[model samples]
Target: MTGAADLLSRLVEEVNPSSAWRDSFIRIPRHRFIPDRIWVEDGDDLAVLDRVDDPDAWLRSCYADRPVVTQVDDGDTTGRGYRSSSASMPSIVAMMLDATDLAAGQRVLEIGTGTGWNAALLADRVGAGNVTSVEIDPAVAAQAEEALGGFGVHVVLGDGEKGYPPGAPYDRVLATAAVQHVPYPWVEQTRTGGRIVTPWGTSFHNGTLLRLRVGEDGTASGRFGGNAGFMWVRGQRTPHGTLDGRVRPDHEYAETSTDLHPYEPVGDFEATFAIGLRVPGMKDLVVFDGDVPGNPHYTVYLMDPGSGSWASWRIRPGPRDYRVRQHGPRRLFDELAGAYTWWQEAGRPAHSRFGVTVTCRGQRVWLDDPGNPVSPEDPV
Candidate 1:
């Protein structure tokens, strides 16, 4: 049976975390925080991985570097398979921890303590009493609180977006969940010069890690770095829908043909990241025709649930012009294509090149530097 040490070895080789966090990774057993009945992706649904049924596979999953689904559809079994909470990828957990640049005795406030493993790791580094974690889900929080009981870690049940004001002036604030906007309360709770690390993304993109340094003047600013696509916070989640429900045959649409393909805009990470910034509230999905292996026939759907708008771009083995269909108020395909063109015109800057400055007023995403604002100030 593989143990935590084996997982640590794999993480060290794959992520190569700094020397500061190597010991914490070694000390925290990830399996202890994970539930016995975890969820793994099985086709379009989530399949349960029972520890009693298959202990080996379950243990392997717990130690794997991949994200482990802890809850689905907000713990509603009857609902569609929506991954609500998860134990983040091991490497990403290491990367985000490294980004905190934490030191012993520093007060840390962690948001979205999914499985309490990260909180335990933080406690291991900064002393259990100095770490305070907030989780929104009741069951998840109760389980985490129990797991962390002996560690002296304080687990609060409340909205993480508001942060825990009682633990004010935290030296470091780490958010396990992703957010569309950096909540002002996180900045307010951190002391000046302290760090706030969280996954920031848009409806179109899940996101990248954002490391911000709180300024003396009550604001936080930093650049986007590392590939950290995490689940969105409950409050900022994008509307979930099925393609069949959103795209109906009875719905009226505008038919057109586009020479541009969805390869770069949809497939390329950098392109999709940039395009997501420009086209807000746009979500995408690619559906393959039939169940044939290596089938090139597929359709890319760009949907904006806010305006009941959707666009379908068909892709096949051949043909220069692909069938394009737009429905409802907004023209999603054109917007995506325009955003892609704009990204190209701007020399195709990587997502890391972009940065964000958050103030009492709102948040603004900038490219290259804070002096140049890429988009209009996003009001909080």
Candidate 2:
């Protein structure tokens, strides 16, 4: 049987979390917080993995570094397989915790409690009474509360976006879930010099870790770092659709050809991250010919469900020029190309070079510095 020490050793070798967090990882067993019934990806859908049925596999999964889906489609068995909640990858969890720069006795407010494993870690670092975690889903929250009952951590059942006002003036705020926008309430609740760490991404990108420092004037500013892609907060999730559902044979589309390939714009991490900031409401997917393995022939589909706009870029093994098709009000392919070109012209800065500033007006993504915003008007 795999024990907690085995998992801790693996985490230390893989993640190498700071000395402050190493003890917590050693003492707290991850499997205890995970549900007996977890979900694993089976092609396009998720299949249940029961601990009672297969104890060895379940225990192995618990100790694995990857995420384990805890809930799907908001706990509805009949619904489509949408990963609603999960125990975040241990590496990501370690990365986010390290970003916090937490200290003992400091009050921490955690968003999206999930399985409460992260909150338990926080409680261990700080005192248990100093940690307050908020969760939206009732079932998930109940389970977390039960798991944390002996830890003395306060688990609140409510919307994470609004934050817990009663626990205002927290030293740090951590959100396990990803968000397109940094909720202002988080800034309002954090102390002037406190930090807020969360995963931030756009429609075209899943995204990186954002660590913001609150200012006295009531705002937070930070840069994007680390390749941390997390499930979006339920309210901010982009619309989900399959290729067949969005694109059809009867639909009329303007056909064109481009020498530019999706190699960088779609395949490159930095390019896609920048393009996502420039081009909003666009999603991309690749489908291989005949669903065969090792097939170089594939089509990359870019769709904007909000405007009913879609683009299909065909890729073959040898051709430099690819066939492109566009339908609906917006030109998604052109926008993507322009954004990619813009990113290249701007020196092709890595995703980490980009930063965000959140004020009463809302959030603005900037390149290099906050004053130089990344907008259509400004090339840089």
TM-score on alpha carbons, each prediction = 0.96, 0.96
Clashes (candidate 2): 0
Per-residue lDDT of candidate 2, residues 163-225 (tens digit): 899988999999999998888899999999999999999899989999999999998999999
Candidate 2 lDDT: 0.90
Candidate 1 on 1-380: residue-level lDDT in tens? 76656865676677666799887787777888998889987876789899899988888888888999998889886668788888888888988999999999999999998899999999999996999999999999998888787887999999999999998989999999999889999999999999999999988887899999999999899999988898989999988888899999999999999899888999888898899988999999888889554579989999998999999999887767899999988999999999999999999999999999999888999999999887889998
TM-score of 1: 0.96
lDDT against the true structure, each candidate: 0.90, 0.90
Clashes of each: 0, 0
